[model samples]
Target: MDVTTRIGVVMNGVTGRMGYRQHLLRSVLAIREQGGVPLSDGRRVLLEPVLVGRGATKLRELARRHDVEHWSTDLDTVLGDPRWQVYFDAQLTSVRHKAVVAAIEAGKHLYTEKPVAETARQVVELARLADAAGLRHGVVHDKLFLPGLLKLKRLVDAGFFGRVLSVRGEFGYWVFEGDGQSAQRPSWNYRKQDGGGVVVDMFCHWNYVLENLFGRVRAVTAKAVTHIPRRWDERGEPYEATADDAAYGIFELDGGIIAQVNSSWAVRVHRDELVEFQVDGTEGSAVAGLWGCRVQHRSMTPKPVWNPDVPTTERFRDQWAEVPDNAVFDNGFKAQWEQFIRSVAGDGEHPYDFYAGARGIRLAEAGLRSSAEGRRVELEEIAP
Candidate 1:
């Protein structure tokens, strides 16, 4: 029989969409279902999440639903408690810095959502603080854990594509223009002051994806556009859209791989999900979606001349085939949470730590600057 390691979780922003869905329901409660993570030394890692939020009623409801007894509206009280060694933050982008800095000062190992801060300087400062405190840290780069992305990684590792050439990412969805009666997303997402915008939100994912699958971005040139100027809120009131609705950026990776990422809030997605990546190499290529991957390759270097008159069948349109789902894990976000818990238990390393998170934020910051200046921006310029 293994003894269980008691872990007290200080979870902030429990009421937010990502916080509740990924952290509360999937990570903490789902781990309970597996009887906790069993260790080889006859010990188990038990997660006890102490929900922290502003609303007492919602916290109480969440606690009751999860059969968790601990809930608190006072963050100071929770942080002062020595029993809790890990502090998790999923607050809005604007509040992430303060919450994380406080957690670090309290000497708790930290895990939080992406875009560590709005600027590269803040991210670097946080990383420095975490290192000085000697606390373990991780950030949510959940896209890497997606089954499709994981499969792409496997292909890359196996050298299926002899020499990687380029990568493309497409992410977007139709955002409702706020009319008098339209149901709009939270207003903050459309306002620059609120840290709401697709560039900041989605580019962080692109950074991790490019870093993990391809390489680090050395420089970037981008163009951002605000396609819609007005939108209606859920309250039947109109608000001005002040943020960019679409962003197109080209990245030069470390090894000469040119990567392009397109992010938009106003584009209509014909696919079930609005994210996909395509990788091209000298010998082969692969296209990955949320559910699966398809591969195309030249078995022996077959050459073909450009022919506009050729039919779709002659262009190897059907050459691509679906790769089997090799993952037996839960959702990507849940997998990341489980890993974070395991790492906190001193069993292994957390893959996306604070440094990685900072890098993503730096890339995003550079993207914004490039769009604003209408020129190329070097990663070294924003390098912490």
Candidate 2:
């Protein structure tokens, strides 16, 4: 695979966890090591990712460790370079709007993490700017590329569900208190001032999952709670947690489908997977997790009569059949990156653009409003 042409990408915030592990190391650099991504006509698209961040020490160590040749602390210098065609942002959600806007203005294609901006208005503005600038852009909708969800989507497309009645999503894991156990997440995640909250974080993911797998979300009724009031910061200083630790939401989607999601940083894991969606339909039911999906057809579904007098012997978990993992699955983020690169190369089209990102933030905003007002909030699309 001797490829002559290459696509230079400016990747900001690559020193962070998601940026470093998922975007930089696994996706971009991995593609680089593989020579290039193959196209249908026996062509290859080479990716050259330049790491950009604030700290030189972190950048130096990261670049050295990951075999990255280019590293820069000044973002403006990187953006000004004509070689870099794409600007990928994985920075803090608060800072992404300005950086992405700058990239769009620079005539660079854009790709970034979820919640493109802290507000839905900002997302719409960015989308409009990208469109006006005639630059192609995409946002991370990594969940859609996951193997389990793909299987579930296949069931829906094959009409195995008949008619979806409702969907139940359980997504959460215990984040250790900074008292004696070190917190797994960044310290800023518990602070509202830093743009942290369960509803804002999780609902963005749920929005696409619901819309893609079931239907478009129309309204939401939500309740949020800050279960932990005080927590230790990165420096071991105690601080008041201003953001919501947990959020329970009920969504009304098109076709009268009901979707319920419970997102928390306080709940312990007791299920088969960290995140699971149990979808009930008229003809059958299926439960899809992060990597696996199980289905129980109506014919195979057991019927249990209400009987308190006699001890039950029927095993519930044994009835469902596991969806076969017949295909090799790649990392979800990498899967999306390949498609985005193909789209950027003018070899394909991508739909998960800024408009999709705006839709995600729109749902998050509606969930927050519903929780605050104690009423159902209807989604209103913004025209920018």
Best by lDDT: 2
What lDDT does candidate 1 reach at residue 290? 75
Off by over 4 Å in 2: 1-4, 382-384
Worst-scoring 10-residue span by lDDT in model 1:
178-187
lDDT of 1 by residue, 81-129 (tens): 9988899998887988998899999999988888878776787788789
Tens-place lDDT per residue, model 2, 171-264, is 9999987989988887788888998988888898999899888888989999998998989988888899999989999999899999999999
TM-score of each: 0.94, 0.97
Which candidate number would show the highest TM-score if scored against the true structure?
A: 2
Q: What lDDT score is found at residue 89 in candidate 1?
A: 91
Candidate 1 local distance difference test against the native: 0.83
Which portions of model 1 show Cα errors greater than 4 Å?
A: 40-42, 180-184, 271-273, 300-316, 381-384
Q: Rate the local accuracy (lDDT) of all candidates.
A: 0.83, 0.90
